[model samples]
Target: MTGTPEQVPAAEFGPPEDDIARLWTPHRMVYIGGQDKPADDTPAQCPFCRIPAGDDESGLVVARGRACYALLNLYPYNGGHLMVLPYRHVSDYPDLTDAETSELAAMTQTAMRVLRAVYAPAGFNLGMNQGEAAGAGIAAHLHQHVVPRWTGDANFLPVVGRTKALPELLADTRARLAAAWPDA
Candidate 1:
């Protein structure tokens, strides 16, 4: 949406995943596009902490724990998606302690349960990016993504426009997930 300062979105956002959708909000634009490389080499502040704190309910969250926790992906690949992160905050997987590793695995099991209950997606994609070249958006903090997918869900939207078409809004998905969290 092209507009002057008064016409800007009230909420913060980021750049489009591709070209078709221009991420209009300021929040998304940062720390997204290929993981910005800093001259100072300092890691940026945690984005999940920042966004969740802003609205008090953006579906972006980190369920705290001694070792690891589950968190919703603010920019999700699919609805009812989330991630497994260790509290230790290491970017590489080898650095994870046995307890943290166990917690990550356990929380991931919970994540699958949570997504299944909430979205009932036909399938799932679970993966991790070890480093910058491998597509790790946050190269310093190693985490696993849990994306729920359906049959024929991949379409021209992302390929043609470089935009993703989500059937439901984040708020609605959050409500469903919040209601389902008790089951986890």
Candidate 2:
């Protein structure tokens, strides 16, 4: 005999709901839907390439070097998640010139220092997702991710619901990090 909706326990009908609370961050839908992703893999279609052409405030750029720049991630995993990349629009790490490589590394290090000063995170995750197969959202333009981590930062939201809770706005984070950036 088939059980009715009321007859079957709620947990038996579908995935069980946990006691964890939710923030209902509907704003993240845009990122999840890939709204602003480039139409093609060319430099002209890449947001990273287009961002440097505009003002720092508009681009959310924290610091700029001769060949590379550091900016806040538009869709951050954590509060102070930032990305460092060269302005040259190169895809492969081997394609970077010595100057570009140097500036990118320097900017990544400075980003960590600035985030530490501003947020006091317990630790950090710094790495580059080289290509699409390696999990790069934008494989056409290489970028290094620097995500600040604190104790209990990995809450149930991300693990259970695939949503992250950001306490601050992106513009505010950009301004704070930009101000905290160290001199060259």
Candidate 3:
């Protein structure tokens, strides 16, 4: 009594399912594929320099300053994760002019305030990954990360599976942050 292709259970041909639930983040493929990475250290090849040229919403820019801007992390560590970067595309923090430095600091503070207003995170991790050795994804562009951290936010998934489970969409989070942003 051989079963026909249709008669056989569909499960028989597929791998067995495990207890771990899968969180399909297809959008991460852009990062995984390295599509948006700068080709070189020059401003001409930098994403940070290019992003400001586009529209705010499309670029995920939450707020703009004279010398720096705040934008959503396309690949966020958590919900409401954002970055404040200078528009000049300089790699080193010391390279920024006094005006750029002042604005970058202000922008970072504003990002934290906005994140707190919208997400009400218990804590935050705000810093810059300076160079490639320091784990900077785009070492050519200096950017400060503003990550909102909630209690118990670091779950087993990230530790065990090396995957983060973000509850909100990037666009949605960007909109919320942009709306909550204060007037310049």
> What are the models' TM-scores?
0.71, 0.87, 0.87
What is the Cα-based TM-score of model 3?
A: 0.87
Per-residue alpha-carbon lDDT of candidate 1 for residues 125-165, written as tens digits (9 for 90 to 100): 99998988998776767789988999877876566655566
Extract clashing residue pairs from model 3. Answer: none
Which runs in model 2 stand beyond 4 Å of their true positions?
A: 1-20
* Candidate 2 residue 24 C-alpha distance from true site, Å: 1.2
In order, how many clashes per candidate?
Answer: 7, 0, 0
What local lDDT score does residue 121 receive in model 1, on the 0 to 100 scale?
Answer: 84
User: Which candidate, 1 or 3, would have the higher lDDT against the true structure?
Assistant: 3
**Residue 22, model 3, lDDT:** 62
- Candidate lDDT values, in order: 0.69, 0.90, 0.88
User: Each candidate's root-mean-square deviation in Å?
Assistant: 7.8, 4.1, 4.5
Q: Against the true structure, candidate 2 has what lDDT?
A: 0.90
Candidate 1 residue runs with Cα over 4 Å from true position:
1-44, 48-59
Better of 2 and 3 by lDDT: 2
